[model samples]
Target: MNAMRLRALLLASLLALGAFAQAPARGGALPPPLPLFPLDNWWNADITHAPVDPNSAAFITYLGAGRGMHPDFGGDSGDPSAPIYGMPYVIVASSQPLVPVTFDYDDESDYAAPGRTPGYPIPNEAKSQQRWIEGGLAGGDADADGDRHMLIVDRDLRILYELYALHWTGSRWEAGSGAIFPLDSNARRPDGWTSADAAGLAILPGLIRYDEVYGPDPIRHAFRVTVRHTNGYVFPASHRAGNTSGALPMGARLRLKASVDLSRFPEPMRKIFQAMKTYGLLVADNGTDLYVTGTYDTRWDNDVLNPAFGAIKGSDFEVVQLGWQPSRSDNRRRSVRH
Candidate 1:
């Protein structure tokens, strides 16, 4: 072949390879940042008692916040600093086992509670709520104590969302019916604030919506939810907003540090983590009360050691870095982006 022809052919091959490398395999615009929070500072807080005003945008922000899981780093077993603040507020109202709830994404009915067996007449309440009694529903028998429910509301006291478990008596599946509960009353703040003072601050989702980005592949992403309840401490709400001027409402103004061991995840999730090549952080405006976000990244081949089960050499997972800055404006609920 002529020298010029050979050069042109080589260049074309290089360009094609670059395009292939940049294309996303199957997932959509990098899965919206997983709901990952911080591990230190504030760990848990309850906003169930906080009044939610349906008329205000804050109310919508609050509802959006309950959409994902808030993870944490170091504290007591249930509470951590990276996620939300308020320990008593972090209620898990699942009738199903935590293991199965977190691991078994395949069995849509695995999280359902055992219902009345054959021969026993369904209770009147169960019959009246036939939709909930059916199988394949998100709702189920809540924990016996009833402490698992957490309510998300706007500043106007409007109930935005409810997080709880459910039980199934009949044999059908649905998404809405379940055992719902509210957070303990002690975690909320006294109401009475204008929309302007709370501008830029909003509620963020707790669960990182992975299916939107990762597709059907099962990958476990670790995150932290930190809630800082300033009941006694007072700061200018306007000042908070001033500090975060010109940033995304749910962006991170502060950076935090965290680490995860891919080996901790089971089978497919573990394998998916191994295949990752890059990752990024995503945060949502849960409510004007707290900041929630998570990390989504490609796994480096070297960080794939299964230390929990046995030592296997892989990559040393990078220590996640984070930061937090006090906003200048009194807008106590400033949404920050990194």
Candidate 2:
């Protein structure tokens, strides 16, 4: 072949290879559309810094103590009328089993009340689980100030999560607006999968779904799980700014660490996770007051994931209508209506 022709052919081959590598993966048949939970208004009061108030009391009551029996034991509380504000509960990693750790604002006198039992027991099975290899306190205590913090340990006995329920005290925003905190540290697992890695992998995709300016938003809710990749390369632009409309960039790759176990999941979940080998992320944004997003790609039907993840129907996971902007006056009127 002529030199010019040979060079042209080589260039063309490289371009084709690049295009093929970048193309979106197509399975034999696309998996059935996953179910979603939708969010309500996106512009509520910035409760992140709001203070504890009557509303905060009610919110905590609903989440912590429950309506009657069968209370959701995950909240930290501060008052009796369910007034004032604090996390209803916090989970900390503990080496010892069965004894509940208390994190209250009132001193030891408060815990010494007549009928108040101070601690709870850890399950025997949980003690034998491999995740709690290095268990620690899963609860918290108040600091010099009255603000309360909560802690949680992952199955691996690692102190992987912490939550600071209400920190701002005696302020109007102090009731509902303390920081909902998370851990800043990272730990390495034997098979990869550090805590930070899991959180990043689980949360990033949902962040992408919410922030992406293009087409209809894919998420209905904000609660989600992100799986991390050990060998993947994040797109420079996507990392700095965000992803563009339609699809991801050409060289984007999400690599996973070795320790994730996907053995007993349903067929659909398995298929989705395997396919994620190519895409590396799966996001579900059910529309509601709560939002969930994550990094791991699993194929369970919407039925399974929603219940397991505390996602509600209709409001918990529904797609957001993009490009439908209301006028300022209209928004003001809508706010009044609410």
Model 1 agreement with the true structure over 1-338: per-residue lDDT tens digits: 99999999999999999766533231123212222122110111111122222232332233242332222211222332122222111111122112212211122112322331111111223223312221211234332222122222221111122222323324422222121111211122122221111211122223333332245543323222222221111111111222332222322211111233565665543443342212212232223222323222122121222232122111222212222222234223323311
- Number of the top-ranking candidate, with lDDT as the measure: 1
lDDT of 2 at 16: 100
- Candidate 1 worst ten-residue window by lDDT: 39-48
lDDT for every model?
A: 0.25, 0.24
Residue-wise C-alpha lDDT for candidate 2, range 110-174, written one tens digit per residue: 11112324332222322222111111111111232332222222222322232222221222111
- The residue-level lDDT of candidate 2 at 159 comes to 23
- List candidate 2 stretches off by more than 4 Å: 1-5, 25-47, 65-292, 298-338
Candidate 1 stretches greater than 4 Å from native: 1-143, 150-160, 163-204, 212-254, 257-338
Q: Cα-based RMSD of the predictions, in order?
A: 20.4, 25.9
